[model samples]
Target chain A: MRLVQGNEAVVLGALAGGCNFYAGYPITPATEIMEQMARVLPARGGVFIQMEDELAALGAVIGAAWGGMRAMTATSGPGFSLMQEHIGYAAMTQTPCVIVDSQRVGPSTGQPTMPAQGDVMQARWGSHGDRPAIVVTASSVKDAYQMTQLSFEWADTYRLPVIVLLDAVLSHMRENVELPPAPPPFSRTLSPDVDVEKPFGNHPFVPFAETTRTIVTGLAHDETGATRGTVGHASEKIIRDAFNRLNHDYAAITQYREYRLEDAAWAVVSYGITARAARAAVDILRGEGMRVGLLELISLWPFPEPTVQSLARQVQGILMPELNLGQLILPLRAAVEGICPVAGLGRADGELFTPEEIANAMTSHSTHAERRVSHHA
Target chain B: MPKMGEDLHQYLRQQMMPTVWCPGCGHGNIARAIATALEHLGTDLGQVAILGGIGCSGRTPFYFNTNAMHTTHGRVLAFATGLKLANPRLTVITAMGDGDALAIGAGHFIHAARRNIDLTVILYNNSIYGMTGGQQAPTTPFNFRSTTSPFGNIEPTFDTVDLALAAGATYVARTTTFDFAEMPEYILGAIRHPGFAVVEILSQCPTYFGRLNKLGDPPDMLEYERNHTIVADEESVISRDELLGNLPVGVFRQEIRPEYTHQYADLCQARGGAYRA
Candidate 1:
């Protein structure tokens, strides 16, 4: 175990995951990732480029991904917004890459040094069009390191950009993390063969192979990678298939942790740094003998629908503690609307939700803590 | 230069016939010259990737039977930079248009040249956004009438060759579709250059630029090119600096600069790593 910041852990983890190309533009809470990449990437026999802007950063990352390299970029809120264009492009082209957003407060560069989870919804739907999104949130330095590597695996396996969402609080926090002793989890980046001929049965996915002349475009394209102009007919189906390809394994792809939630009446649904407080808040509620629990969601997109719905049946109410103005609550409410009453405990004051604050919010917002579980059908 | 013996038409996607471009658009001539240039250089099509932006010129990649990427508007150079760095052996040919390169993607254009990365960039200077119905491009000459500029364009034009040279491109040249026989040579020279190489082709847009500006048919547009542009030769003293909105068709700059990817490879080697970017 060694002491490392969440941002430093992300750099170490991405390199371990066989990331060969890194293109990034500096932003606070994420610049360390770029600086470390620039320092060590060349020595490790990889490419590190500081692009003109966040738009070009993601663009170059997508291009390197097409070249069959495990490429990535790191940025904060403003940079993430700039990246939405190429994020949409990466989705349309079905190129695999990893993007780490060490999120800070923002409608637009809201508070550079402060922490806020305002980009939770943006990560899922920032880019225009109905594109596929795989977003995973890291709650600690360990989670940040582990998920950064897992992000690469998921990006390649799903053939889409995997966003590892981090907030300013977690990014700056230091912790003792035990990194893997081996070359790390993602060993596949070395082979650099996506095998589109057998797997995707498409040429557009492979950029360098000679046997299949690849053609990648952002427009709605037919199976031949030719532009179909309109988004209807065969090309529409192609786009649809590409967009929801990861949904088939939604349950598997979407992950969450149950913190003493096996037996509870009221629960808190939270993720990232807020989830840390929620976990502590759950322990506080249990001490008060309130029969409350915590459900820490890891994968924000491909949301754990079945798990959240199952929890709603067992619990009478759920309090969603978030750093934003209740972004994830919309999905949480939809999951448990008819079964139970759900409330949002939001804090976007560029600070984290304390344990006592979360506990107080849960109890005050709880709709009749004594309500029977029999209220559910 | 004894012409390369083998026929390069094998690299053309003959199966994908009926190009999307309208009739009399000079884009087709420039594309043919590119194919001929590839043939002249004996570049293996399999190892070549034709990357393009969103415009009439952007569609050039789909016609080539090589590895191609049709990217977003004005972002072809950004993609090409990454693609070339990822696979240093693969020759990346960037195809972009006037508005795509000089307007929306102008930042990437200068930066790619500033890096001096190895790329064969073909800028199709049509002076109009034909794909979007002939809006005025950055290269549109003064007093020109476009769909967007109904009366007359009062804005000055961009000298593409000068911009390229100023951006630190190792090889900068300009040609015209009217100079059809000699156009391939410029493209061939760009392909052979080891660093950032740019070839701006003054392609005519008869469909829009011709119709709106009363430049007549495609033949008349060719005549305009023959009358307006000066060909650079040993006797010529005019520099691209004094373009004054008129086209200058010739090689403008060629220098010995350290190519980005190759320098990176040397860095990796010095660091004792086997991989070369």
Candidate 2:
């Protein structure tokens, strides 16, 4: 086990995951990822390019992915916003690539060095159009390494852009992490022969052979990657299939950890750095004989709705403590769907929530639940 | 039941016929020139990739039979750069318009030239944003009227050849849709060059630029362009101002410089790992 920063772990994770091309522009809190890539990727026979801006960074990553390389780019909030257009393009073209957005406080260039989970919703809905998003969050340095590797695997497996959302604190914080043995590089399965007339098959899910001459466009296209302007239902069918593929595999896609929920009456739902405090709060509340548990989310998008539904049945109330003002609570409340009461304890002033603050919110939620039950009775 | 030049079918996507270009638009001529250049060079269709931006010129990739990527507005060069670096064997080319290249995509154009990566850029200079109804573009001549400049354009125009040369492109050339005889030769030369090569084709947006400037019809515009151009030679002593209105149409720069991807390969070789292919 060696101590390393979360950004450094991301670099090691990307290399171990077989990332061969990294195109990025340096941004606060995410610059280390780019710097490490520049220092090491070339020596390892990979390509590391500092692009002109975030738009070009993601653009190049999509291009590299089409060139049959496992490519990635790292940036902060402002940069992530610049990449939304190409992110939509990557989704439409079904190019597998990883984008690591190390979160900083911002609507636009807000505290670059400070941590904020304001981009949680943006990660899912930043790009225009209704596209499937696979976003995973890491709360600790070890999780950063593991999740970064898993992000590449998921991107390659699903043929979509997977976001590894890291906040400023988790990105800069250092912790001891045991680096796992490098897994065999995961590559897209391609056919050996080429059908020149139909390079891409009838299904967008079906992987096209690199040997085949194919056209990949952002326009509404049929299975063969031909633009079908106001054509039949081919475009709609392909987009539906893309979303259905992920939705059907919810068991594999949804990832979360439940703590001390054997017979809990209330729970604290959180992710990223806030989960760290929520876990501590859960343990403290348990010591005080309060039935409070923690549901820590690792997979933020395609949100574990089923899991939340089940938890809502078991718990009377859920308190969501986030760094932003009630971003995660929207989905959490929707998942609960009036089955249970959900409250948010948010802080967007760039300070992380303390264990005591989360515990206090849980206590107040329990009191409010009791008062409401009595009044209803 | 095929046409006379059925062999050209190998390079085209026949299904996406009835191109959206206006009847007199010069983009068709530029596209034909590119097709003829590829045919002349005999490049492997499977190993070639055409990337295009959002404009009339951007749609050129959709007609090609090779691997094509119709990308975002003004960002095809960034994408092409990555593709070329990742697979140096692929012949990558980008098709963009004046507004796409000089206005929004100017940063990428300059940076790509500075890097000297091996790729070809075909800038279709229509002098107006034809895709968006002919707004004044960076290449629109001074005192010309566009939708945005109804009275007259106050800003000076950009000479793409000079821009490419200043950005350190190893090969820079200028041609026009009117110069149909020489367009393919210039495109072929640009494609054959090792480093970043740009061939700026002064195309006409007859529906927009022609109408706004009262330049008669497509034929009239072509005739005017032909008469205004001077064939640039090594000993040419024409001043920049003179060349602006009466354009100099020929290769302006060709130099031997270290290419980005090739140098990267050499670095990988020196480092002694499994990166070399």
lDDT of 2 by residue, B133-231 (tens): 989999888899999999999999888988999999999999899988778887888888999999998888899999999999999999988988987
Tens digit per residue, CA lDDT, model 2, A50-91: 899999999999998888788999999999999999999998
- Against the true structure, candidate 2 reaches a TM-score of 0.96
The reply for model 2, stretches above 4 Å from the true place, is A183-189, A193-210, B1-7, B239-244
After superposition on all CA atoms, how large is the RMSD of candidate 2? 2.7
lDDT of 1 by residue, B3-90 (tens): 5325756868875567888899999998888888888777678789999999999999988988889999999888898888888888
The 10-residue segment of model 1 chain B with minimum total lDDT is: B1-10
Question: Would candidate 2 be rated incorrect, acceptable, medium or high by CAPRI criteria?
Answer: medium
- Candidate 1 wrong stretches, greater than 4 Å: A182-205, A228-231, A367-377, B1-8, B233-235, B239-245
